[model samples]
Target: MALMITDECINCDVCEPECPNSAISQGAEIYEIDPNLCTECVGHYDEPQCQQVCPVDCIPHNPDMKETKEELYQKYMIISAA
Candidate 1:
């Protein structure tokens, strides 16, 4: 699954730079994770970097954008190719 920044985000700004896919960005109110570009750091790290750095723990798996580990790796490969 992709990850999402919830309303609980404190705008701490730590998560943005930690995203290997560059999927996290400053939204109108909070940081938002773009599902299309998110791979949960599958090919880059053992864990989601943003989730690791987020102080408020507002980032969570996006149930609405579920994907298997294989799918996430595919996405990561595609993104890396680009």
Candidate 2:
């Protein structure tokens, strides 16, 4: 599944750089995760880097954008190829 930044985000700007796919970006308010670009670090790291470095613990799996590990890997492959 992709990940999402909740309203609890402190906007510390740490999670943006941690995303391997560059999915995290500054939104109108708190940071936002692009589901299209988010692979949850399936092909880059064992764990989501943003979640690991996020001091506020605002990042969470996006239930609305549910995806299997295989799906995430496929997405990662596409992203990597491009």
Candidate 3:
């Protein structure tokens, strides 16, 4: 599943650099996660980096764009390959 930044995001920019997949980005209102680029850190890390570092705990699983662990790994590999 992709990780989403909720309204509780403090915009402290803590989660941006921690994302191995480069899925998090700054937005007008709050930080945003690109589902297409999000692999939930499956291929790169044991757990989601953003969620781990977020002080506000605003990073949440994106149920609307769920993917199995294998699929997430494949997605991450595909994007990071190039």
Candidate 4:
């Protein structure tokens, strides 16, 4: 599943750099995670870097965008293939 940032974010910008896929970005007020770019670090790291560092713990799975590990890996592969 792709991780999402809730309104709890402080716009601290901490999670942005932590994302290996460069999935996280600054929105008008809070940060946003791009589903196409988010692999939950499947190809880059052992875990979701953003979730690991977010102080507010606002990063969590998007139930609507849920996917299994294989799907996540395929998504990562698709991006890397490009």
Candidate 5:
């Protein structure tokens, strides 16, 4: 599944650079994760880098944008090709 940044985000800049897909960005409020560009770091890391580096642990799986691991890998391949 893709990940999302909740309101709990402290606006700490750490997670943005840690995202391999460049999916994290500063939204109107906190940092946001674009589901279209997010592959849960499947093609780059074993786990979500953003979650690891986030000081407040505000990143979590996006229940509304769920996808299997294989699907995530496919998304990763498509993104990498671009």
Candidate 6:
């Protein structure tokens, strides 16, 4: 599944650079994750890089955008090829 930044985000600007797919960005309020560009690091790492580096643990799976690992991998492939 893709990940999302919650309101709990501190806006420390740490998670943005950690995203392999560049899915994280500063929203009107806190940081936001783009479900279309998020692949949960499927093609880049064993784990989600943003989750690992977030100091407040505000990032979590986007329940509304649930997706299988295979689907994430496919998205990663498309992202990588582009």
Predicted model with the maximum lDDT = 2
lDDT for 36 in candidate 2 is 99
Query: What is candidate 4's lDDT per residue for 1-82, written digit by digit as tens?
Result: 9889998999998999988788999998999999989999999999899989888899989987989999999999998988
- lDDT of model 2 at residue 44? 94
Q: Which ten residues in a row have the lowest lDDT in candidate 3?
A: 1-10
Local accuracy of candidate 5 as per-residue lDDT tens digits, 1-82 = 8999999999979999998889999999899999999999998999899989988989989999989999999999999999
Better of 2 and 6 by lDDT: 2
lDDT winner, 4 or 6: 6
Instruction: Write out the backbone clash pairs for model 4.
Output: none
Runs off by more than 4 Å, candidate 3: none
lDDT of each: 0.94, 0.96, 0.89, 0.91, 0.93, 0.94
lDDT of 6: 0.94
Which stretches of model 4 miss by more than 4 angstroms? none
Candidate 6 TM-score versus the reference: 0.97
Q: What is the TM-score (0 to 1) of candidate 3?
A: 0.95
* lDDT by residue for model 3 (1-82), tens: 8878889988999899998877889999999999999998887789898988899898989989989998998898899886
Error of 4 at 23 (Å): 0.8
Candidate 6 on 1-81: residue-level lDDT in tens? 999999999999999999989999899999999999999999899999999999999999999998999999999999999
lDDT of 3: 0.89
- Over the stretch 1-82, how does candidate 1's per-residue lDDT look in tens digits? 9999999999988988988899999999999999999999999999999989988888999999999999999999999999
lDDT-best of 3 and 4: 4
Global CA lDDT of candidate 5, please?
A: 0.93
Model 5 misplaced regions, further than 4 Å: none
Tell me which residue pairs clash in candidate 2: none
Give the distance in Å from residue 45's predicted Cα in candidate 4 to where it truly belongs: 1.0
TM-score of each: 0.98, 0.98, 0.95, 0.95, 0.97, 0.97
Number of clashes found in candidate 4: 0
Model 2, span 15-79: residue lDDT tens: 99999899999999999999999999999999999999999899999989989999999999999
Error of 5 at 11 (Å): 0.5
